[model samples]
Target: MSRTIMLIPIGSGVGVTSVSLGMVRAMERHGVVVNFFKPIAQPKSGDTGPERSTTIIRNATNILPPEPFTMQYAENLISSNQTSDLLEEVVARFKTGTSEADVVVVEGLVPTIKHPFANELNYQIAKAIGAEMVFVTHPSNDSSQQLKERIEIAVSAFGGHKNTRIIGCIINKVGAPLDDQDRTRPDLTEMFEMPSSKTNTNLEVLQMFGKSPLRILGCIPWNPSLVAPRARDLAEHLDAIIINKGDMDTRRLQSVTFCARSIPNMVEHFKPGSMLVTSGDRSDVIVSACLASMNGVKIGCLLLTGNYRPEPQVMRLCERAMETTGLPIMMISTNTWQTSVRLQSFNMEIPTDDAERIELVQDYVAGHVDKHWIETLTQGSTLPRKLSPPAFRYHLTELARAVNRRIVLPEGDEPRTVKAASLCVQRGIATPILLGNPDKIQLVAEQQGVKLTEGVVIIDPVTVREKYVAPMVELRKGKGLTEVVAREQLQDNVVLGTMMLAQDEVDGLVSGAVHTTANTIRPPLQLIKTAPGANLVSSIFFMLLPDQVLVYGDCAINPDPNAEQLADIAIQSADSAAAFGIEPKVAMISYSTGSSGSGSDVEKVREATKIAQERRPDLIIDGPLQYDAAIMENVAKSKAPDSPVAGKATVFIFPDLNTGNTTYKAVQRSAELISIGPMLQGMRKPVNDLSRGALVDDIVYTIALTAIQASQQQ
Candidate 1:
């Protein structure tokens, strides 16, 4: 849809900068090409040259237009008494630059009591520009209805056109110290207003509404970087310890560039609020400096200006610095001059002053104002709005909403496994058919403190022996096993349960909780084999953390796979990511990016990368890459500038099982990140293997993932 959406701030009280930035950022997140426009900007007197807001938008977007394309002084376009000239200039900018843009986000003037011109100007701009009106208000208990009334009156006074859609209202900065706030004030919705709000604590409101009808385009948190006086001033305000004893504090720390010669000094001086300046290839130095400075002060971050790394002696010095300081260094991969230039134009203090006010305005606009009733009045049509389910709904409420799908959990000596399965069923996430003695399963659940409610379907292996015998006999026919022996093996029920998945009696199977990986996968492999076109079976650990989801491959299977097998692991991990709704950008992780390192291990990854590309011609695959190069954009750009899968890689394919397992665990332990799965893939159906020491949440997510996988197949 080619549409321009402009956000106009009426006056100075509301947080116009923050709201404008947030809308732009949110649009970017939605993969929409949007442009920011400010028709009339009045910066404080001391501010030099152009408006600070213009610079902020330009910095955030990294797009500097030439001459008329950029915003000029309001007087240049509009005459002294004619406010309409300002609106005309804004519309012209939108028409000129927004040819290919999906939306044009124009920040409006703040709403003021005395300056009726601001509101009048906004209404005229909306009408003249053929734009929809979206009012950004602060969060107040009764503000939703009041704002709606005020907007209706303003639009009416300005001669509202039939083409103009009062899209809705956005509430900013909710959740203050008021504990007894009435969020569900019925008057707001009854007043026929479209509402959406952004909270101060979580910036995910945009993410949430993006998935629903409310259409919360973006929720920008108050970024500390937006403040002014550079990093040094912020350090003083926050009482940050300065590591660089030699660098002058008054040197306008706006753009703290990391210098190679001063890296050791930079590492020591790495404070949270400052920017890092260093050489590009000196990632080792940069990483070490960050590690060292991680102890006391927050390193404002790194800015790698030069395209070079530190020498070995400097690297050694950085390592020592890391041992001394213990802080994380931030590194920017841009060239030194470019980094400095970008930093210089940006005024940091623009964000600090009115971030809270912007948030409050957004919350107020987004407050629970009804859109359905408003649509009837505005468009003469009745539309129903979908309200999100309340948080902490009862288990029955969720269960009633779920599709009926049957899953089987094979019984074993480890009753904890069965208990975990039973708990998943109770939680309404899965319907598990436990393959073991019902009495024994109950006993295990009791011992483990897991409630085995009526939801679980238990099938005793003794009673179901005959049902699995024929399948076991068929599976073991070529292995020189007699019917009796096959029957006994099938009595294990893990084998029988796997047979059910193979036979399509159940949608999916979950085992390996009590059994070893070998035993658990052996039966499935023998009977099910690889899926069509899948050459080899592999496993992946869905290493999920609070902030990110990473895939580590060959962690549970293939003790020490060769190059070809490692390649297979990469392809399988990529497939797993695709199955789980993530675009798989596979990186064959090693100790090197390209030819930076020597040794058979590096060669193995290089060969695996080639093999993986040959196998999955459509996938973006790169190899012999260090961990940082695979995930960090600056490192990726610096190390492998031409490589497609370097910095933006999502799936990490390890060279061997040892590195795969060890690296993920080390990251988990050292970083205090959560790791789920060692999830098995490449089977015919969705049968997953769990860790012998799996937690309840682990079992729950695994079951959910398995169900999702099975649903896709269906």
Candidate 2:
């Protein structure tokens, strides 16, 4: 079960999105897999895209959050007195997106004239999802006592703080302490619309909440950079025409300057990232800007007024400077004063493509948030650590990054393989060596919009096949001593890659995106062989059920094992589960529960359980249990009351491949869950096989698993 944290705004424009994003990053820094969710979309005025919070999260991180329901949908439900249905929908979407996360951060809807029931909806949704609340508010002209009363009222509406659902509060956009001059003039405010002078200071706010049950998470100070818009945004807002569109998308305007003075005086305001607004006839100002650009000053852009374009001669004279500096230049019909007025009321919504600013805001807000509180939330957690699918995948990526091994991909020319290889290299999961024709692989990457960076190594099989032929001949000389057969076998990329792994040239191998499973696993069995265990190779798939991740063993290998081989498979599966961070609660599956029924299969399972228990008593191993009794608590209590591993089994060992494979496919397809592998265990070297219908993400995670396996062998 995922823990939920809801951020509710005390008033409009409280920066709830930023607060939610900050909390997520802070939790991630502590190594928790966090998911961001917004139940309803609240599009601001003139905004036609997706909700800002979801967009920012998707662009900034690897997590792909679910799209929010539109406001119209919620409105219709509320109008028809179907609010219960609305909350049911919210809960369904929430569970769908967050079932695989350790923690989920939900951003509540902001109260506006268009939606008066937002606050009530927020409360109802939080209750429906069982989310703890974190009230987000800014100190805007409210005294200490006034702020305390406001929060008290909100808490009472939320069933009071006695329930402890209201965990804490964040004071965002805290203004700087007022100086004597500012204190004397109560109406004075900063240029960037900082908190008013009447608002209480940080100390006053904290002291006010000292006696309250809610914790004061942090007081985030006002940051003007977070509210600044890019030059491209300004251009779109003013409907300006481009004169020299350079760095418009990336250059952010930190401040606006009106060049009303002469060249000597106006040049003093030429700061980097400052937008200069002046009449188009000011050739002197244009010449000064060109000179500043030549001297390494990167002003955001030059905004011309009154539909003016610079004289052709002046632009021609500064052509070299413009070309060298790539200064962003644009013109608008509005005069200087009009433009300034529009700038004062500009929209400050963060765009989806402004990745640099999004990262800046995430880091900035996370830095100001309470680190000790975050540590307590993550380190001192008392919730059950049920491994979800997202959490498992996140764990794989982090583990693979720590190891940083090289993995060989045999089907590099395949489109999905090429994209997955590029992603792995870019994300530092592994250094994947793609074995194919370099030109063909490059063409595939270009077609897929994947940038093959320097980290993605492309090795042509034709050049490397000859080198491996002699080594393969020596390794398999006992089978038949012939160079011709070795060369012929080396033509297959899977065989070549397996030989590489056998020779210790690469850390691991992942293939079968385009090849058959036999083609992938045969070479490894022929060359690398099994580990120094007294048994055959077996396979397991990490079945990602809705609530937790379960392990199903012998699903892809080993048909009809006897008592001894079944016991060995159980032991190997348990070891693999433990290695990958899953608690090893072994359940030997059969058609019976305990001694209820007798058959050859049930007897085999019973004997296998006893042998496994004798071999490793530390593991929780029980046998001859039905699938429902092994997994469901009620069934376990009724059918196998005294069995230790009757319920809550994380690893299931089948008596034969026929049962295992059919059961795994049934559950996987019926539930539409993600199944990670058929990861081969008991291999001397780390060699894994993939499915022919694998997606890019499936391939990437398999590579990560292979890397972790290689590291474990070391």
Candidate 3:
């Protein structure tokens, strides 16, 4: 059974949507398969576009949450006294989307002026879904005592927190308490949570509960970046005419600078992500903006007030700079002062296209949630957690960031490898040392619009090959002592990278974006070799199916094996699944299920299953089962009713490479799923190979897997 947590706002503007998303992210970081559900679409305010949270989730995550019922449909149901039907509808949608999830975070409706029954509907939905309530609120001008009372009232309305149904509270958009002497109004930009240094208000708010049963799970500090509006959002809000729609949809306005001063004084305010609001008549300020754009300052936009357009002469002169810099420019009818006033009341809703801001908000808020409380949600749960694709990807990056291993990418100058290296460094997943010519790598990075950040180390192969020649010659001397052959082999980047791994110069190696599997793995097998285990090297692909991640073994290695070797492969695959947080239920796949069929393949599979079970009694190993009985519950009941691993197998040990590789590719393409590997197992050091047709993300995740394997190596 899956657990459900519903986030309901106790007051207005508590940022319930963001808090819900954050909860999902926090759980995913802990490797839980979490799902998100918004019961009903929120009524769009003005021209702010689609329901904010729903749109963001749809665009930003691999999670395909069911589209929420329209507000009109919900209102009509309630007016006709069909509240029960409404609750049933919500429950059906929630169950349909979250059946395989470990935890489902349901976003409750925020009570608005026109939607007074929001709280009641939220309560009913919570009861219907058996959801634990997490009341969301923010600190206001009211004293801590008053805030405590409000929380108490809200908790009492939700059955007074006596039972586990009332999980806790989340205080959002928390910042410093206001001073009595300070009469300045809070800045409009201070709306959503920011990375504020001052958190006195958060402390006070967290302590206000004062031994109340309701736990304070999170105290998200104010972060202005979460609410930063895109340039196009501002333009649409102000009904501004487009001057130059350069990067408007992507550029975010972090701060606004009104050109109240002359060119010399106002020039200091020009900076990246700052919107310059100046009248069009001010040629001095406009030209200054252009100059800043030319100087590589990514000015958010140039918003001209008073319905004015720049003179044709000024436009002609600055057109080249604006066009080259892709600087957004807009014209608003309101004067400077009026525009500032309108900006103060700007909508804080997130646009669907602002994926960066949405992810930022989720991660930022997730950081502040109590880790202990989050851990408790996962502990002692009997149900197996189905690791979703997003959860797996997030876990890989998070784990890679913690280990921070150095991985060598042999095909560094390859475009995908270059981009993946940059992304890995930027995301703190790994320090990628790219092995290629520096000039060629730079050219590739530039062509791909990838900034090979400082963390990405590039080494010229010519300079490094000679150093590894002696070592390679020494390692292969027993086979044939020849420095000439060693030097020739070291010319291959994969061989050079494998030598580095063998020498402990790098923690891991990721290659094969441009090379064949044999070209990639042959050097590793020759130099790095197999681990100290009693068996041969094998490979597994983390097939990220729609519902969960399954491990398919020996897909990229071992053409065929006897019963004993197949048993060893099954053990290795099961252990691998367990290492990656997947519960191991090894299934030995064959053309027939159980004792019903007699054939050489079935007998081999049955004997292999017996050998595996005898070797590792702890793992749930079953065999001679067809693919359908291995995974389908009904088929398992009809075919192999007494088998422990019949219906729910996380690891499939194929009899041969042909079967494993074909099945993985077929499922991956037919289901449109992502397979993270071909991740080599049983290697002494972490040296993973990629597909020749691998995308940038595929290479990045493979790098992460290699880093994790390196860190976890005994």
Q: Among these predicted structures, which one has the highest TM-score?
A: 3
Candidate 2 lDDT, 55-146, residue by residue in tens: 99987766677889999999999999999999998999888878777788899988888888988999999999999899988765556677
- The per-model lDDT (C-alpha) reads 0.58, 0.83, 0.83
> What lDDT would candidate 3 get against the real structure?
0.83
Pairs of residues at least 3 apart in sequence or in different chains that clash in candidate 3: 193-222, 193-223, 194-222, 194-223
> Higher lDDT: candidate 1 or 3?
3
Report the Cα lDDT for residue 230, model 2.
Answer: 82
Candidate 2 stretches greater than 4 Å from native = 1-106, 111-375
In model 1, where is the ten-residue run with the lowest total lDDT?
Answer: 385-394
Which lDDT value does model 2 have at 18?
Answer: 83
Per-candidate clashes come to 72, 0, 4
Instruction: Report residue 294 deviation for candidate 3 (angstroms).
Output: 18
Q: How do all models score by TM-score?
A: 0.47, 0.59, 0.68
Q: Could you tell me the TM-score of candidate 3?
A: 0.68
